[model samples]
Target: MSGLYRDVGVVLRTYKLRESDRIVVIHTKENGKIRAVAKGVRKTRSKFGARLEPMSHVRLLLYRGRELDIVSQAEAVEPLSPMLSSLDRASQGLAALEAVDQLSLEREPDPRAHAMLVGVLRTIAAKPSPLNVPAFYWKLLAHEGLRPQLDACVRCGDSEPSARLVAFDLVEGGVLCRSCRSGQAISEPALELLRDILGGRLQSALDREESPVTHEVAALATRALEHQIERRLRAVAMFERG
Candidate 1:
């Protein structure tokens, strides 16, 4: 556990370094999230150039360096090529990467986060449901202990049954009852959809006619995640732009 390491991970993103090298952002199962320099990867005949591309799942051999780890070798585990076959699938995959990249820290072990992302990517590749993206985000937040409080008034902890979610407070981190309401108005349907998302009902929750509040729920999840991680998520922004 000193100067060298090996891990199986998914490529989150890559930044070009000089002309023929790349700095790859990866979410590794054993070593958590990390960035390592893949030297000469941009060369015409480089071994790992294709394997190190974003959203690729591969096993990497790394050597510790003073500044950045160097990728000594890379072998493809699951290239995840299907997820990149269409624009929709590709967007979902990249957004998933951005979400994981923002939520996780470098060199931290997060098996739950890692598995959640890998599973979500596999699901998206198969189904490509719109709700899957937001559901993935909310689920990741729940895993990180940032799930929005939906069962009661955030201020009073009043658990009395109410249809309308009424208001949501990002700072308070949940919904506020009518009596304790100084938050953004959100509908009961939105709250229910969010609940289903957390409960792993991606397809069923989105099976009916699309509700306007569904977009609101996605926005809320993004805002909540950004609030916790304190980083603006380009995943949400870019996905919406498309």
Candidate 2:
């Protein structure tokens, strides 16, 4: 807390401060979330301005201050040009960034969540797909121990979900069996997609032929995350707009 410290971080969000300074929220691999001031960031020739953009992975050097730290130096560790070049990829990547910002705590380390953010952003940069956003949401939820129970009923513990009108209940936080049906009913196909996503079969879920149910799964995943966090996410709304 005295000298300059360095950490690998993902720029989550930034707010303009005064004329040239800015407040940046960064999620680090070792220090979780940190709100620090980046001086002279509004200047056109600022070296680290682009590096502080949301979803940019950077190795940051900081000096701890009384209330917030000051970003002394930042080197882009993972360039986000590929993801930013495409609007679709950019939206998904931003949603991942915003979701992590909203769901995480300040100064608390969650390396798994940090790694998941980096992994998902890299995936978006490498392969821009509609499923990556929801996959990131699902992975974050699971990291927070809010993983939906799709294998069996949330109430009766019935594993033969096919026999029932497969539905996911946000209130119950998982799939509901026939005997415990509570929320809106979903098709078996949609339920299967959710299962595939939660079961670590992301490639299968994404590689599967395009279908209406995939959108349904996206909506379901978004709703589930929103319900857990108890707030509508701006990134989710923005992604839905396009």
Candidate 3:
């Protein structure tokens, strides 16, 4: 193991250890997800306290070990304090972190996923808008290889004459069209807007001032993500309640 090294990372979660220490989980740009002990972080006067909070983006000096690393020093890159201060933005931020945590494996380098997550965090911190949060989530899922087929039917792979109703198969990782939805659950509006969102046409859908479709898409996307991850995220539940 290396004696010490530096990496830019986003704090995914943190837990108190002992009276004045903390265990932090961070998604780094260089080394991917890592867990490190932030000694004395729980202390009131600890310099690393603010930098160890969830959603905080920081440059950390890590002392690598066989099992876990130690966060020797940390400097804030983007505190994300503003986003964490707002209830809605905070919930969204937590949801994003939880999703990444659920999908990412330890010490695996995924630069695209890391960049997407950092971008999402920056956006949420700068602007507290739920309108684009679902879109971000959808894009992340796509990046993670769980994107559902929105342009055509997943069942028969139809390209011509789009279906009125589309049934998203969370287990199958795509959508089924009207003709293929004989015994499958289908949602027409949700499927349509999902296509739009996946195609990066969310602005067009929102320009029409239609929110129901977005809502449905959000729900479906969440369900699909949960199925892929095989576990329900607590942050998502908190987001829904908020």
CA error at residue 147 for candidate 3, angstroms = 1.9
Count of residue pairs whose backbone atoms collide, per candidate: 0, 0, 0
**lDDT (tens digit, per residue) of candidate 2 on 82-185:** 87788888888888888898899999999999989999888888887778888778878988998888778888887772547467788988888777888878
TM-score result, candidate 2:
0.94
Candidate 3 clash pair list = none
**Sorted on TM-score, highest at the top, how do the candidates line up?**
2, 1, 3
Which residue runs does candidate 3 get wrong by more than 4 Å?
Answer: 160-165, 182-189, 202-210, 239-242
> The CA-based lDDT of model 1 is what?
0.83
Pairs with backbone N, CA or C atoms under 3 Å apart (clashes), candidate 1 = none
28: Cα error in model 3, Å: 0.3
> How high a TM-score does candidate 3 get?
0.89
Selected candidate, larger TM-score, 2 vs 3: 2
Query: In model 1, which regions exceed 4 Å deviation?
Result: 162-164, 200-203, 206-210, 239-242
Best by TM-score: 2
Candidate 1 per-residue lDDT over residues 1-242, each given as its tens digit? 58888888999999999999999988999889888999899999998768998888888899888878899999988757798789889988888888888888898999889888888888878877767677888888888888788888888888656533489998998888888887688788888888787766766775645458777787787788788878788866765687
Task: Kindly report which residue pairs in candidate 2 clash with one another.
Answer: none
**Best of the candidates, lDDT:** 2
